[model samples]
Target: MTLAVCGAVSACADTSNTPASQRGFFGGIGAAVSGSDERRAAGLEQSATDAERKKQQLEARLGAANADAARTQVQVQAAEQRLAAVRSDLQRQKERLAALRAGSPSGSSAEEAARLQKELDALERERRAAQDASTAVTTATLRNLEERTRAIGVALDRLGAV
Candidate 1:
């Protein structure tokens, strides 16, 4: 009887010909659990790869922007320098006109004063044009740079959150 009982137990335990699910209640649980874990791991890996690609793209854009900003800065500086030179020339013309008017009250002196006054007027116009150009360069370039920088900052922030 003991031998018969042992045979019955061995038969029940022998699962070589049984499908995994038919072997027992927990027979296929490992495969199911491991499959889900593998899928989750693959999903996480994909997300990481996407994030890294985005970061590299953003960095490239930032490098280009920085180079553009540097160029714009140089342009602004040149514009400012030109404006300053125009202003200096205008001041000198004004002083010369004042001196000519103050020197002699004769007819020839009056003619010379008028000529200087015309020259001064032309210089004033030149100064105004230079100032306007400088202002335009500063406004447009700086505003564009500011917008680009803000966009980059936002992108970086989003990447960090991810």
Candidate 2:
């Protein structure tokens, strides 16, 4: 009777075949729970990787845009300087023309002076055309740079929100 009772108790407490890791309270529950946890962790990791990649790409584009803007600024400055010089030269030529007109010369010399005046006028017109073109180009470039900067700023704002 005692042997029979011991056998019954031992059979009821059967844990010898169970793996060590699965021998705790609610141990079998880990199999289902661990699968979900692993999937969640993997998803979070992938999201982090994607966000980082996007951030790096945005930063690269911003850097390139800033460099382009800097170069454009330098070019605009150079154009402005050239335009200023051309205008200064035109003013000086105007002053020389005025002085020549005031001091009337003899017949042949007057003809020579007239030819010189015509050449100076043509040069002035060419310089004015060049200045106008340079100004237009610089204005357009600056406007483009400004718009690009605004776009980059908006992109950064969107990225930060993400």
lDDT of 2: 0.57
Instruction: State the lDDT of candidate 2 residue by residue for 63-121, as single tens digits.
Output: 99999999887876787775565556546655655565566655765665566556556
User: Quick one: best lDDT, which candidate?
Assistant: 1
Model 1 — TM-score against the truth?
Answer: 0.50
Candidate 2 total steric clashes? 0
| TM-score of each prediction | 0.50, 0.53
lDDT, candidate 1, 1-162, per-residue tens: 966654555444544344555645433343343353456568779999999999999999999999999988888787787566556655754665565456554565566556556755754665566567774655554344334434433433333333
Task: Score each candidate by Cα lDDT.
Answer: 0.58, 0.57
- lDDT for model 1 comes to 0.58
Query: In candidate 1, how many Å is residue 29 off?
Result: 4.1
Q: Give me the runs in candidate 1 sitting further than 4 Å from their true place.
A: 1-34, 103-135, 138-162
Q: Lowest summed lDDT over 10 consecutive residues: which window, candidate 2?
A: 25-34
TM-score of candidate 2 against the unseen true structure: 0.53
